[model samples]
Target: MKDLTILCGVEACAIFQNSFPEQPTIWPSVGEANRIIEKFRSLPEFERVKRMINQETFTEQRLKKMEAMLKTQQKDNRHKEFTQVIIQRLDGSSAILPLKTDDDCVELDNVINQFIKDIDRKMEILQNEGSSSNPAPQVS
Candidate 1:
């Protein structure tokens, strides 16, 4: 499989793992990711999670949003590091690993934290781009 990065949150991860138990979906916010970690910590043992990498799992728009967020993250310095990333296997099992450094997380793991930072940044950009404080008269 190619490099597939899902932009999802911790809570959404838990919900998706618990609810779907078949399809894998990435959450697009830090809040959701935190929730998933918390859920797992509360659990008695680690749960195996499965994630399917395909069009059915993610929308084109969402993917584009992730790309945009990535770009935004690259430019911003506020959020440049992440502690961990959750890796889900094809069989529906998952593990959370700490991100020690760029060397520690190779490719996908390196981007996980930046992706989280970009989610909100992308949303903020989208929102600002869509809204206008004052409605101007049409020149046409």
Candidate 2:
């Protein structure tokens, strides 16, 4: 039995065991097992059978079980619609603003416009200060 178990490592042997569980054979030696495995692998149906075993099982009962599991999970979970406004800056920074109502969108627009105006005003002040300090070398 232990010797037969070792032969299961071969692909053909494993497929044979799965396909015909009732009739199990014990090869006299590993070389004999290898020769038989080679013959089985040479058959056209070997790859097909291997693929069938590896593929997902989609039997009717299995699908019904999966559907029930999904329904149960859905019942336990709370689903909500989320709305967000993403602001991306030139310096590779980002801000996400979540909105719950129409009024929040209107308020967000006003806030963003005011923020741009503030930045422009600060830039103008900086430019004015830079020009005054330099004075363009008197430009006579």
Candidate 3:
């Protein structure tokens, strides 16, 4: 997969992207993504937790199992957010496999973070190009 590199070094050629070797999607996906993430960030983590547990096993035993395992996590604040993404990707679609462990969740979080940064940068550049009469190409 190619990625979008908005910020670059002084050389403007050091930013590497593997996902977006060509151009970005010609849609309003970035701003919508930012808005969605903003809304997700504002919600309580428990909301995602409930959503995850809803379609899966919500037994007290299972909850305790996950709770104890995640008790020492430093990502409690981002848990719901990460969880929401996991569920959305895993459920009602065959695009991605479901996250069954904390490790999977971590990996997914990293992937999502990179995607978010890349997309936001791409959208920024595209928007700037659309509005600016003169645009300088950023080395990638």
Q: What TM-score goes with each of the models?
A: 0.21, 0.32, 0.28
User: Model 3 residue 10 lDDT?
Assistant: 14
Best by lDDT: 3
> How does residue 114 of candidate 1 score in lDDT?
55
Candidate 1: worst 10 consecutive residues by lDDT? Answer: 1-10
Once model 3 is optimally superposed onto the true structure by TM-score, how far is the C-alpha of residue 49 displaced, in angstroms? Answer: 57
Identify the superior model by lDDT, candidate 1 or candidate 3.
3
Which has the higher TM-score value, candidate number 1 or candidate number 2?
2
- Cα lDDT tens digits for candidate 2, 1-140: 44655677643333234465586554445676688677766769967586454225657658889999997775333121111232343335564455667755765666567668988999999999998988776565
Which regions of candidate 3 fall more than 4 Å away from where they truly are? 1-92, 134-140
Q: Residue 50 of model 3: what lDDT?
A: 55
The order by descending TM-score is 2, 3, 1
Q: What is candidate 3's lDDT per residue for 25-72, written digit by digit as tens?
A: 522355655665566667789974553444346677688888887874
Model 1 Cα lDDT, one tens digit per residue, 1-140: 01233334223342245565586544554586677667667665434234324575578768889999987886353233322223243335565444456755564544665567888899998878777754667898
Question: What clash count goes with each model?
Answer: 17, 0, 7
Is candidate 1 or 2 superior in lDDT? 2
The numbered model that scores best in TM-score is 2
